[model samples]
Target: VCVPPESVQPPPGSHLPHLSSRVMANLDDGTQIGLAMSRSIGDPEADRLGVIPDPTVEVMDVGALVQEAAEALKVESEDEVELLAVSASDGLFDHVTPETVALEMARSLYEKEGAPRPLLAAERLIMLSSRFWIEPQQVAYRDDISLAVTKVNKGGKVKA
Candidate 1:
């Protein structure tokens, strides 16, 4: 999500030096998601004003991508993989950026095909990353489920 400079405002009572800091975070599987802090969803105000979807194709399965790359590259560990988000603008932040975490793995796969759809890569990464947000039972079963969020969270304890 990208926020315009004009719309960005600090919380009700806080004094920050400037606007627009880049925050990048890496997930357990090594996918990087980068967020333009000033414009990121962290701040509801900024997010509501303006936000943009990533242009690159997202790769959801970061770990799977790494494994695939490792196998393709003949590398032993996920650490051996390196990725760069071509669309990520440069900046700094106190915490990891979601875009940085998300795009890293996407870039790796995109690069294999000579820089294809960056947004598409991002989407793919997101889909794969859903593996971690899944229910423990689903993970164990390795089966598709359409359980409602309420039921899933309560482990079927909630009464209808």
Candidate 2:
């Protein structure tokens, strides 16, 4: 029976000549290769036979990666960590410390007890605000005073 025109017609523009064999065998490895009918390389029946290039495999530069890792380790692990992070509520103040707060409290208490009459709110605030900061420890004491002042400012009565 005569084959259909669509089935018999070769691919467009590939110049590979039609050899006797349905599949061309490689002399080096006896593996068979088919014609490139799907590719747009002109007529396949007249195309010349040649060696196809093999896919390349790339090698990773492991020595460079190791050197970079060693440098990073050397830099990061050199010195001891300096400043330790602490919570804000850990008796630390912006400018006053716990010892200074204690000293101020002592001074205020001494002034209050020495006074013949009770101190007014303005007078108490004046005593607290007049304190000068000397060190971080002093500022830390003021942290407690800050809390106390916050409570008082919020309309909570200060306990004796």
Candidate 3:
């Protein structure tokens, strides 16, 4: 569920900056969800804004996730596999940024299982562009190496 940005309270000693009241007021009339900012993510703008990184790390069964994805993509048992991690967020102040979620997921997987590196090194990370005015109701998953390569080559820009 989404909440107004004003309703989100930063944790104690958090160095992250909150969204300005003016920006909050200018948002659509729908509930606002603030995205957690990370100053240490090496983004100059994020550091300048004093955004705090998300602290929550949710660990999932990577094998299970991969299996589900493989099944959905109709891959054969002997097919080579790569894992693409995608995070989706409704464009709102209260929602966590898709980058943060994707990063945390990769970090957690690396620390726990140590297999996603080869997958990630193969350029398998994907972050869906934040959607405005609509939440994702369903996703059509496909494994398109050419598309992924093109996105990476273009500096990760998703065409609308």
Candidate 4:
């Protein structure tokens, strides 16, 4: 998780430049990079700000979460909706939450035009999230978005 640059509990004994939150770190190459991520790789300046590449393992039941959110979408049977996992870059998460994506997928399943599928749901999610990242009214940025969605049958086979 990325904490505020100005937050208390800064890296132990690492004195950052003044106005720490605005500018993350200054590299030896005369380039300054601003970032708040707590864990990363290939960033020497970030190391000064206490960022580490060490990964934290968090185990969660994403399938249960999606199933709960898509409770309204179970038209045929209880097992009709079996979402196994979700992966996305910060670009997608900066604008939308997992709950929003799950709810949107559930909503997409109800469309009247054609067959409801997770692939279509994934496309809708990218399009919706892009509005927040690229619009001038919103927080505009050049960061790209990436994510995945798929269904899993009882036999553990994946369906796109």
RMSD vs true structure, all candidates: 20.0, 35.9, 15.5, 7.5
Off-target runs (Cα >4 Å) in candidate 4 are: 1-4, 7-36, 41-49, 52-56, 60-77, 103-123, 136-140, 153-160
Q: How do the residues 23-101 of candidate 3 rate in per-residue lDDT, one tens digit apiece?
A: 1112577675554323233454443345533434476765666677578878885133344444332232234454554
Q: Arrange candidates by TM-score, descending.
A: 4, 3, 1, 2
Worst 10 residues of 2 by lDDT: 78-87
TM-score of each: 0.22, 0.18, 0.26, 0.49
Better of 1 and 4 by TM-score: 4
Query: What TM-score does model 1 achieve against the real structure?
Result: 0.22
Error of 3 at 64 (Å): 0.2
Clashes of each: 45, 25, 6, 0
Worst 10 residues of 4 by lDDT: 16-25
Flag regions of model 3 displaced more than 4 Å.
1-54, 85-160
Can you rank all candidates by lDDT, best first?
4, 1, 3, 2
Query: lDDT of all the models against the reference?
Result: 0.45, 0.35, 0.41, 0.61
What tens-digit string does per-residue lDDT give for candidate 1 at 7-115?
Answer: 5557656765345544455789988775554333245554454553333356555556657878998988766665433333222112225555444544545355565
lDDT of 4 at 106: 51
